[model samples]
Target: MGAGVDYIFIGDDFTGASDTLATLARAGRRVRLFLDPPDAAAIAEEGLDAVGLATEFRALPAEAIAVQMDVLAPLLKALSPRIVHYKVCSTFDSSPETGSIGAAVAVLERHLDPALVAVMGGQPSLERYCAFGNLFASGPDGQIHRIDRHPVMRNHPITPMAEADLRIHLARQGLQDLLLLAWPEIEERRATLKTHVDELMRAGKKRMLFDACDQGHLETIGAALGGCGSDGRPLLIVGASSVAEALSGDLRPPGVAAPAQGSRTEGLCLVLAGSRSQVTAAQVKAARRFKPMPIQPRHLADKTAAGAFAASCAAALAAGENVLAHLAPTEDYRCSGAELSCKLANLVAAILDRQTVCALGVAGGDTSSIIVRRLGFRSLAFEEQLDAGVAICVAASDMPQRDGMRLMLKGGQVGSDAVFDRFVSAMNTKSPTTPSGLWRHHP
Candidate 1:
């Protein structure tokens, strides 16, 4: 294989990967996301400028993350992209035990070396910002809180953020001495940004963290990144989908972008919610269109009950009713979260066996990763934007029944309450010819 692709991204989870797919495609670049790490030959056939690999690294232990990376690095090296991006959640969700960014980076470096390992600190589109190297995110109530103080992320079940200072947080995961290019320097020395990083590198810092609040900052950062490495090798990057947002401006043609809508889907859609977040709970409550199927401990623990649950969902879909399968609110179950998620995933697979939906919507970051991986999808292409942080994608698979399936994978904290309604409407209507309001820029 040759250095033919413009960018290669490895997402820590499916939600972020799908968001990046929307980013690149909306920017007018041809991009596809593979559920598994794909080969150069398979990618070349798609005629894409960008290729992505989605993984469940965000929900795995450090040892398991390292093991997955070790298996992936060799194949990634063969892709020979101009930039290798490690895409993380805009919230920077990870911990020393699970989803350790440092551990994954260490394993990757053992196989491929780059001049710099740059970390972009904020994705304003997601209301995640960093100033002076301390990360911040927004609450559903629309308040800006330091990540460690954020209402939901502060108490996230998988990786609760304890420190706002990214350096300290990542250092705890083994990435030490990261040089920060704060907003002041990024603003004051916008023209000499790359030179600033060079000086920082000369001062013994090998890794870099950049602060950005808007598109201008991302473009400036993208320029600095694009200008790196005279050796003609790809720059290795880390951050949210803004990594694509930064680079995409150059690839997009004037006035051309990803469509905001596709001709609305014309049949019943299926939605699965595995996130226990209050935000998702609100969306589920506000929904009036779907036949909600609430999961219980008995439904998963007892095979007969599980079959009844799956059959109920399939019957609803077959009867021309939209379906929303989720956990009941304010209830506790005697099982690990992972076990519950796995059973939910099995139900999705089983339902697909009996019923076919015009489109599928999935909520929750970790759940999206687990279910998409379980479904044996080969690749995903941007179908349309459901909302900020949520994208409707078309899934391609080896199975005829699954190929060309329309999918929307959403992060738990993302989108508006009417997001589900919008998916229902978007699927049954025509997509917009112009791209606008695909995302919101937090000021």
Candidate 2:
């Protein structure tokens, strides 16, 4: 059991899953993320220490989330992992209707039935903090703002965060009676921390939150969680990629080493974005090498328009040029978010069916999930860190043409203005005439 994969995670979105992949791999762990639960033979073949399933529940309704988790429950129970992490966004922006974190916790609890369910309070590596029960994150302007007051999240299209106190926020989604171990309490020695945790467990406080304001705090929380698994009761943790970082004992600065150069085959580089986030919009604007093509909401529902759009993109890629297909930054289409995602995915799939691409970049969590699933990729391996929470992965597929395709998945708010540029640069660094190192897994 100790030699097998130590952790199994179900990320709320593809971007979040990739971030955890980066966290574990950078810590020197052999990790792999599957589009679905793989068999024992597949796990052994990959030689993995961690496995994850990428999902788009962050953009789904509560009923939809329940149905999705129901299918995943039995799969998780069969793995018998040391820890099962339900990865959420660091800011924890969710509502009852869409992206219900509590809904997921309840579903997982009913199935796995672990002795304890822990919620890690913050991920410092991403500049997010949890202090005295409130969540704070760095805004796009580099200002520290309470999550509820953060400029971007407060006005987020899908799940706007209106509560700063996580207790209150989660309470809205029907989660209550939570026990919190604040930072001051966490700063004490390991013995004291362990005693306090034991006491809480004895008191039947199965759902608890641990304060994590900095790297040191996260390490302490990590040690506590690591200890629990050794004691024969691995906790069901709910939090961000920081949970992976903590468990792996890797809190070093992210993106420390140069990202591995991607495959540079003589094919087009296609970058697609379904996020209207300011950060993603900036990246789209900065991606000067690619031809920008915007798909309107109306076109998504019309097959003729969608096919035409796909044709244009295919033509662009066939001309030995890159293409950036995205929604305009100013467009707001809430009701059509899912439809637009599917359309974008189908559009990309169609283009890929026509032209060969050296690499593909997907921006937006839901968009990444839909695209990856639609493309029929079975498994992925961590390649490199193209940005803060962004990873370039190598796809393993049964289709020969799409096999070993390079993919970059990014959350809406992650990456810098020049992230798209860096992606193109990564592609250019490799010799177009030679085979790519990304074809083989380093682990």
**Candidate of highest lDDT:** 1
Q: Who wins the TM-score comparison?
A: 1
- Residues 404-436 of candidate 1: C-alpha lDDT, one tens digit per residue: 778889988888898888888877765542223
Off by over 4 Å in 2: 1-4, 251-267, 332-335, 431-443
Spell out the clash pairs found in candidate 2. none
Clashes per candidate, residues 3 or more apart or on different chains: 8, 0
Candidate 1 local lDDT, residue 343:
80
Candidate 2, 300-419: lDDT as tens digits: 767888788888998988887889998887765545778778878898998898887878999998889899999999877776677788877778899999887888899888888888
Hey, what RMSD does candidate 1 come out at?
4.1
Could you estimate the TM-score for every candidate?
0.92, 0.91
- RMSD (CA, Å), each prediction: 4.1, 3.3
**Residue pairs that clash (backbone atoms under 3 angstroms), model 1:** 26-258, 261-431, 262-431, 264-427, 264-428, 264-429, 265-427, 265-428
